[model samples]
Target: MTDTGQAEQAGGLSVVTTATDGIRVLTLAGEIDHHTGDQLRHALEVTGTARPRIVIDMLRVTFMDSSGINILVNAHQTVTEADGWLRLAAPTDSVLRVLQLVGIDDVIQCRPTLREALAL
Candidate 1:
């Protein structure tokens, strides 16, 4: 596993990136609102990889708004178009509720643990 270090921080959000095998794991902490949406989007952007497999660990995310939802939806679409997949891991109750309410959980896979998200 290789740590990509801290990828971005804006407002109350912090994103740390790491890679194992070919999958990129983004561990996020703090709130994800309009102010932090760009940071999250940037962290999700695929660079060299053709089919970027990504897992977003949201265990520490305390809050999220429509902006965050939009970012996630856009990122999911982008990756899916590239034949990649994006998964959400261990989101808190509040975040999971939001995802479920918005039907994001239906669109993007949400795993109960990081290990599950990382699994094929």
Candidate 2:
């Protein structure tokens, strides 16, 4: 239960970042569109960690667009290249449908709950 204090709010998105047992968890709320994609990207960026394990708690996310999808794909690739992984957790029904439609669910693991996503 460590808070990185890296919470950020931009556009209609709010991100609260915390670290649990070395895993970075980003709890996101609001809409994810072109205007807020940069904020999401910043939050996903790994600073000093060689292998970054990230779990995005998306339960509160209200909406998402292509920009969010692209950012997520890029982040997934970046982390995978470093032998790490990114997981999406508890996305709302609408957001989950979007991810599924874009085939993101097949690429990145999406769990039904944050606790499940964080479980190793």
Candidate 3:
């Protein structure tokens, strides 16, 4: 277990934030698409400021569109530029499929669990 942040729910998704050992984790739920991509991007932007070692727990993310992928890819670039990294944790089967299709799984680190992502 790690230090956890307060949880908040939004229109298309919910974010449960946590951080420990210099890593920040965002547990996400619901759909991620064009309509909600900006919001998610904004939340992730804050992580980029403090430390871009971000782990996005996507266990509850039922769906993701290209917009979601765009935001995540951009975040990865930012994190990498800052000497940090981004990880995607426990994405749903469908979401993982999309990521694989786009070769994003190769570009970004994907972990089986939040704990695993944090450990990395």
Candidate 4:
């Protein structure tokens, strides 16, 4: 898991990375707001630069605001420009609602599970 130093502190959002067969999965937890969104973006941008298949497992994320959504949208464009794709996996109901409300859920694929995201 690639530990972005910021998430290491207490109660900070954590971005853990694991890759298999060139598919990188970033497991995110805790709040991803204005403060932590940069950490998430950095991790995704770094991984997105190398791998085409990127799955973001948000099953454990407690809260995500507009900043977090913006990061994902930017990441989506980054991956797609490389002929790759980004999938958001297993978001909580609250997060899912926000995504749907903004129509991002339609633009960016949101899988029911990490396994499902990886499978595609």
Q: TM-scores, in order shown?
A: 0.96, 0.98, 0.89, 0.87
Clashing pairs in 4: none
Which 10-residue window in model 3 sums to the lowest lDDT? 43-52
Candidate 4: tens digits of C-alpha lDDT, residues 34-98: 98877887788744254487899999988889998899999899898888889999999999998
Q: What's the C-alpha lDDT at position 101 in model 2?
A: 100
For candidate 2, write residues 1-75 as lDDT tens digits: 899898888879999999999999999999999999999999899877889999999999999999999999999
Q: What lDDT would candidate 1 get against the real structure?
A: 0.93
Count of clashes, each model: 0, 0, 0, 0
Model 1 pairs whose backbones collide: none
Per-residue alpha-carbon lDDT of model 3 for 1-120, expressed as tens digits? 475666766677888777878778888999998877877887788442654688999999999999999999998999888888899999989999999999999999998888888885
The collision pairs in model 3 are none
In terms of lDDT, model 2 sits at 0.96
RMSD over all Cα atoms, model 2? 0.7
Q: Which parts of model 1 have CA positions greater than 4 angstroms off?
A: none
Poorest stretch of ten by lDDT in candidate 1: 1-10
| Highest-TM-score candidate | 2
Please give the lDDT score for candidate 3: 0.86
Which 10-residue span in candidate 2 carries the lowest summed lDDT?
A: 42-51
- Model 4 poorest ten-residue lDDT run: 1-10
**Residue 73, candidate 1: alpha-carbon lDDT:** 96
Q: What is the lDDT of residue 119 in candidate 4?
A: 85
